[model samples]
Target chain A: DARVTQTPRHKVTEMGQEVTMRCQPILGHNTVFWYRQTMMQGLELLAYFRNRAPLDDSGMPKDRFSAEMPDATLATLKIQPSEPRDSAVYFCASGPDRGTSPLHFGNGTRLTVT
Target chain B: QQQVKQSPQSLIVQKGGISIINCAYENTAFDYFPWYQQFPGKGPALLIAIRPDVSEKKEGRFTISFNKSAKQFSLHIMDSQPGDSATYFCAASGWAGGTSYGKLTFGQGTILTVHP
Candidate 1:
């Protein structure tokens, strides 16, 4: 079974450092989503893409967060000047199409800032 | 801000019992509803899904009961097993044009524990 793969299963960085997480979506999947998971807020969608193009990123913090799909297989999310409050698990999910399609998720990268 | 609302932050059930979780959505434009199952440290997997055209859809031991009029849907796990224990999330999506083929809105998750 094809799976969504995320890099750096765990990450720890300083509050002012930069953090970049990568995702390799399942082959043939056309859509990708970035979400943040915290104990208090559950899961929140930060951004999403389709066919390597961004669709909606309104959920993301425009100041420091960016999501991109350089190619069909690669999707990346970057956070600059990470804050302690940014500590959470970042998840990447991909799907073929909307409507009846289902998303396949990765193990997620656990980010912790001090 | 919460377009989708899910109840029972957590649930506990014995083996062989039926496990049920419910969800309601405010967006009437939502045409597709899906339930995802997530294990610790793992990604959420699609368990079952339903469309507004139908009231129910089933796969193996999992079944989705959807009530379009009420804008509500639920998952029922028949003869639940300990292995079925996990966090379940209910989500909704609408078909969008172009690269944005689908846009999803998710609900707060519900944790289910099946005791053996």
Candidate 2:
């Protein structure tokens, strides 16, 4: 079965380090989304791309967080100078453009910043 | 601000019993609602969904009940099983006309534990 693949299931880095998470969306999917999950905030949408173009990144912190889709299958989220508060599970999901299509998510990349 | 709200952060039910989770949304523009089930260390998977046009939708033992006027929806699992223990999340998305269309707003998840 097709599934979204995420790399580095776990990551631990000291403060001020840069963390990068990558996702390989399902083949033929046009929409990709990046989300951060925390115990206090639940799941927050950081950004999303449609057709390899960013549709929204308003939820992302422009100063430190960046999301990009270099190609249809590759999507990445990077945090520079990561702080302890940046610790959370980052999930990447993809789906078709159809309004009702359900998002297929990757297992996630658990990041810990000390 | 949390646009979607889900209650019963955690629930416990005996096997063969019914498990219910409720969710409410403040945005009337939301036209599609879907529920997701997530197991430990796994991504949330789509369980079931309903639209404002339908009052209820069911697949096997899982059902989604939607109420447009009340701006609320619920998930009911009949004959809950031990394997059914997991986290359930309710999500809403706006229609085609709205800017947030296709961008799902997810509610805080509910962890369900079924005792066998």
Candidate 3:
């Protein structure tokens, strides 16, 4: 069974520290999405990439958050000078860009910023 | 701008009973709706989905009821089981112009607990 893999399943960092989360999408998937899950906000789309190129990142905070897919297999989300409010579970999902393909998600990376 | 709204932030049902979750969307442009089931520490998995063209879709004990005119949809699980207890989310997507075809807008989510 193919699945999206995410690293650093759990991360704890002090405020102002930099946090990086990594995801390896399914081998043949062309679309990658990054979402943040919080109790107050539910799940919010942070960014997405199609064919190794970013299609949107409007939901992300440009001043501190960034998402990049350097290659098809690797996608990363980074937060510089992370704040306490950044604590949440970040999920990475991937699927085919065409039709109504369903997204396969990683287990998620839980970040706790103090 | 909460495009999608889901009711019953939490629900409790006895085993062998029916569990229903309702969701409404404000965007008429949304053409696809899907439900996801998530367990603690795990990612949300696609359970079932329906398109605006269809009024209902079912797979096994799970079913999706869609109302295009009302902009509402619901998930019904027959014979609820304890293993089914988890967080459920309703999501919608549609053609929002350039490269926005599959971008999902999720609901607030409902936590369901099944008691024996």
Candidate 4:
């Protein structure tokens, strides 16, 4: 079965350091989504792209967090000068198209900032 | 209007029993409701989904009961087993290219422990 692949299954860094997470969506999937999961907040959509075009990123902290789809297959989420509160499991999900297919999520990158 | 509230942060059920999880949405525009199941160290997977067109949808032992008028939904797991222990989340999203389109608003989640 096809699955969304995310690199760096786990990350630990010091505060004020930069951290990057990468995801490779399933083939032929048009939509890619980035979500953050924490015990308190659960799952929150950070950003998403459709056909390589960014649709929404209102849920992300623009100051430090940035998400981009360099190509249809590659999506990256970077956090500059990370903070302790930024620790959470970041997930990448992909689907065929808007309202056409179900989103398949990756195992997620668990981030921890010291 | 984008929040989906879930009840009973945790639940315990015996094997061969029933497990119920409820969710309420504030957005009237939300037309698609899906329930996701997640085990430790894994991503959430779509278990079942339902639309407002049907009040109830059943697939094997998993069922979704939706109330359009009340803007609420519930997931029922019958004949539960120990393997069913995981975190469940109820998500709601609207279609038709609205602001909430393609964006799922998930509830806080419920931890279910099925004892054998």
Q: For each candidate, what TM-score against the reference? A: 0.95, 0.97, 0.98, 0.97
lDDT of 2 by residue, A66-99 (tens): 9999999799999998999999999999998776
Model 1, span A1-114: residue lDDT tens: 899999999999999999999999999998899988888877888899878888889988899899999999899999998999999999999888744677788999999999
For every candidate, C-alpha RMSD to the true structure in Å: 1.6, 1.2, 0.9, 1.1
Task: Give per-residue CA lDDT, model 3, range A48-100, as digits (tens).
Answer: 99998898999999999999999999999999989999999999999987778
Pairing residues by index, what is the TM-score of model 1? 0.95
Chain B TM-score of model 3, please? 0.95
Q: Proportion of native contacts found in each model? A: 0.53, 0.58, 0.67, 0.60
- Per-residue lDDT of model 4, residues B1-116, tens digit only: 78899988999999999999999999897888999999999999999999899999999999999999999999999999999999999998886464434479999999999999
Give the distance in Å from residue B38's predicted Cα in candidate 2 to where it truly belongs: 0.5
Winner by lDDT: 3
Model 1 segments more than 4 A misplaced: B96-102
The regions of model 2 sitting more than 4 angstroms off are: B96-101
Question: Which runs of model 3 end up more than 4 angstroms from their true locations?
Answer: none
Q: After superposition, how far is residue A81 of candidate 3 from its true place, in Å?
A: 1.0
Q: For each of the candidates, give the backbone clash count.
A: 0, 0, 0, 0
Error of 2 at A57 (Å): 0.5
The TM-score obtained by model 4 is 0.97
Docking class of 4: medium
